[model samples]
Target: MKKEEVPQDESCFSDTEMKEVIYAVDKDGKYDKALSSGWETKTIVLDKSLEHIEERKAQAIANIKNGIQSPIAYFMEEHRMDIPTLASYVGIWQWRVKRHLKAKPFQRLSAKTLQRYAEVFEISVSELKHPKF
Candidate 1:
């Protein structure tokens, strides 16, 4: 091996040392019990490599971010939406509705007050009074 390529005793780490690093422990420290370890040799099988999986994860995150930039993003940010009502009642918060009209091309709302706003927007009054998302 070349001079630079030569592995040093202090620098070189064994599987046990590698495991300690992965678990974020010291030389003689114990790894936390609450951790999962899967191996390629095990029953699980997929053609994709770890890099490919990470790339897909990054892409998915990008897509979610882009979705947030849309008119629908106004609704998500304006109020803490009820996950159950996602399919049933399509609604947005009072303040975000104005911003949506000014910036993003969206529908016109008729309500001026909070109660009227909820009724016009089709969201419950409870959701409007709760807090910003």
Candidate 2:
């Protein structure tokens, strides 16, 4: 059955709107101390099951989508993220990080780096590509 017709009441995210929990640091003192000293992230949950959700889910499971382009890459196919950010989290150089995000590392990967990312994220290589890898 199609997602919209699946009879599911709703999902915990939005289909039309995109949101990010930006942990920004304003060292320039742009605002009140309370606002500037901490993180600020935007989170949204949608309940509507759309036709594209299934495809996105599949890509996520297959780990072939893309990079850590955005935080919402956690839930949607179109939301696939870029490589630099994922590299930052993975502690690898951006280019090197791009090499191992396929849920399966190719010939250029090291067992140690792959294992570290897997342990830190608590997901198999396959699932790593599903998120903002």
Candidate 3:
């Protein structure tokens, strides 16, 4: 692709100062770097990915409401984190974290453990325990 032909379509980064670096051919056919806001195909794929994430988040919230999962599950999806990542951040074992995703085990958690989760989610312990869905 030619430098001038580099895509500059508006995308998720359109409201930000970020740009995608793309390599293209300049006027003399020399390879050059071009900064693009984004491209259509990439934006479409990103939109789809975000939609999927949102769907998962909603499912988590639903599970919490139905008592099948704990608030930790909802917050995990909200923060776009997986069990292992949440466990590492909270300095807990992955298996323990997985168990806490269930309501019974989550209710049995100590204040210190809840505080750790609150800190990772950047919320108060109260908020972590009583998530607003």
Candidate 4:
């Protein structure tokens, strides 16, 4: 496509300095890099993905409040991590991470264990034990 014809559709990046690099044919018929704020379809897809993540986080918070899950569950959702991923990050077994997702088991966790999770979440141990929702 011609450089001047590159899609510059406004999107979520409109308020920021970020731009997507797109290759287009220049006036001399040579490929050149063009900057785009964003395109409509990509914007819609990103918005939907973010919405889904928010929904998941909300459910995790509700589970924590209802005692169906632990504060670890909420932090896991907030960090966009699954049990295996979180376990890998914290240097624990996947099953242990799964166990910790339950309120009872999480309550029995040692401070050092909780500290590992907090480090992975980049928060404090207190925050890990008592998430701020």
Report the candidate with higher lDDT, 2 versus 4.
4
Tell me each candidate's RMSD, in Å, in order. 14.3, 15.0, 1.3, 1.8
Q: Pick the candidate with the highest lDDT.
A: 3
Ranking by lDDT: 3, 4, 2, 1
Q: Candidate 3: TM-score? A: 0.92
Model 1 weakest lDDT span, ten residues long: 3-12
> lDDT by residue for model 2 over 23-128, one digit each (tens)?
3334553432221211112112221334456556565545444432321234324333345655666677876555454433443456676566665556676554
**Local accuracy of candidate 4 as per-residue lDDT tens digits, 1-133:** 8988877889978899999899999889999889987889898899898899899999988888999898988888888887788989999999889999999999899989988989899999887877886
Candidate 2 segments whose C-alpha is farther than 4 A from its true place = 1-57, 60-82, 102-108, 123-133
lDDT, candidate 4, equals: 0.88
Model 3 C-alpha lDDT per residue in residues 6-99, reported as the tens digit of each score: 9999898989999989999999999988999999999899899888889999999888888999999989988888999999999999999999
Residue 27 lDDT, candidate 4, scale 0-100: 82
Rate residue 81 of model 4 by lDDT: 82
Task: Report the candidate with higher TM-score, 1 versus 4.
Answer: 4
Once fitted onto the true fold, the runs of candidate 3 whose alpha carbons sit more than 4 angstroms away are none
Q: Report the Cα lDDT for residue 61, model 4.
A: 89
